[model samples]
Target: MTRMRIEGLLAAFPKLIGTGKQHTYVETENVRYVYQPMEALYLLLITNKQSNILEDLDTLRILSKLVPEYSYYFEESICKCAFDLILISLGHKENVTVAQVKQYCEMESHEEKLHRQMREDKIREAKDEMKRKANEIDKNKAIHVIYRL
Candidate 1:
């Protein structure tokens, strides 16, 4: 639901601001949105309206730099993976350097990729188990019906 709303807001921006105007941030009553445009997509960050704009800009810059380091493609899945790396690099720091971000991204990306793979494997195993159980139950039901006849 939140993702849908963010995407909707992102889509609405160009129309609201006019096509030629470039906006780095948008502030509402309750929230502030900072976005960086890539080749095929926009990366958005949402923050409290009261937060410092300068800090937000710094964070946004750091995040945008990490994009090219992760993948050359701007597809949603690649973006998601890149976002994970960005989040990991940011950690609890208010400021970070390019080298720190790059190093952290490299160290964490491998672990995150492995974690994602394990999670997907578990989901797949669960699905296979459910299918097997379902088939077994169906077979038993058919056998009972035959015995009844």
Candidate 2:
């Protein structure tokens, strides 16, 4: 499904989920939300109605197991771990570990830092050029005023 629709459904999920004993799965007209509650958090899987419920549950089970192994604090960093987990789960990545994911995140962060530094350098160069042009303009104006006088 589209990202917006998925986000809409997820946004409405808490109301649909209710309190007390949670269900293993919740069904809508076109999608199913298979979730496993982890302490104060939830490990959710969104799948189409045509997909196999059993398989979805199994995937959720595996993810629920892996979540704890990768994250202990359930902070924002868990999002990156989730991405790696999804890649591994879909066979897009193989034999990956939490340490490997951390390395990958670090590499991405380093690249971003380099890009940011380059952008700053370019801005500084542009500002220097502007200042030089302004100074040249002021000198020309002074020379013209002296000649006119």
Candidate 3:
């Protein structure tokens, strides 16, 4: 029975992870994307990119309380798509704890930092553009904003 179940999981793994257009276990809104562990992490990272004040290690402990299964499983399955099962199970859960919020914030911040440095690059870009416009008004020439050395 256990062997059959594991075999079933392997057979249905792709569809369960949303890899196929017509999955047996789930039919996503797009029905085109694959759902995997990294994808979950990526989503978590993307949604909380603006939170910079999160303390992830501590937050993980906090999240463990509200979602011990999720918290523990996430770390364990950080590299697999099996977390999708957890995602489905936890989908309707209400009222995530502050730690869960902080955990997501940390996830996003780490992801964003990997792509951008100096943190507030977007804000600096807008400021630099305004400065360039002011400079152009005075001299009628293009001004360059070199953010890096």
Using all chains and alpha carbons, the TM-scores for the candidates as numbered come to 0.54, 0.53, 0.22
Best by TM-score: 1
Better of 1 and 2 by TM-score: 1
Say which prediction, candidate 1 or candidate 2, comes out ahead on lDDT.
Answer: 2
Question: In model 2, which regions exceed 4 Å deviation?
Answer: 75-84, 87-149
The local distance difference test score of each candidate is 0.73, 0.74, 0.43
Measured with C-alpha atoms, the lDDT of residue 75 in candidate 1 is: 79
Q: Which residue runs of candidate 1 sit more than 4 Å off their true CA positions?
A: 1-17, 75-93, 108-149
RMSD of 1: 6.2
Clashing pairs for model 2 are: none
Between candidates 1 and 3, the TM-score winner: 1
lDDT for model 1, please. Answer: 0.73
lDDT of 3: 0.43
Q: In model 3, which runs have C-alpha deviations exceeding 4 angstroms? A: 1-109, 115-119, 140-149
Model 1 C-alpha lDDT per residue in residues 9-54, reported as the tens digit of each score: 6676555434445778877766677887777776677777877888
Put down candidate 3 lDDT per residue, 1-149, tens digits, no spaces. 26685465455545445343442123333222222233244222111222222332233334334343455565456555344212222423344566655465457556677667655777799899999989777664333233331
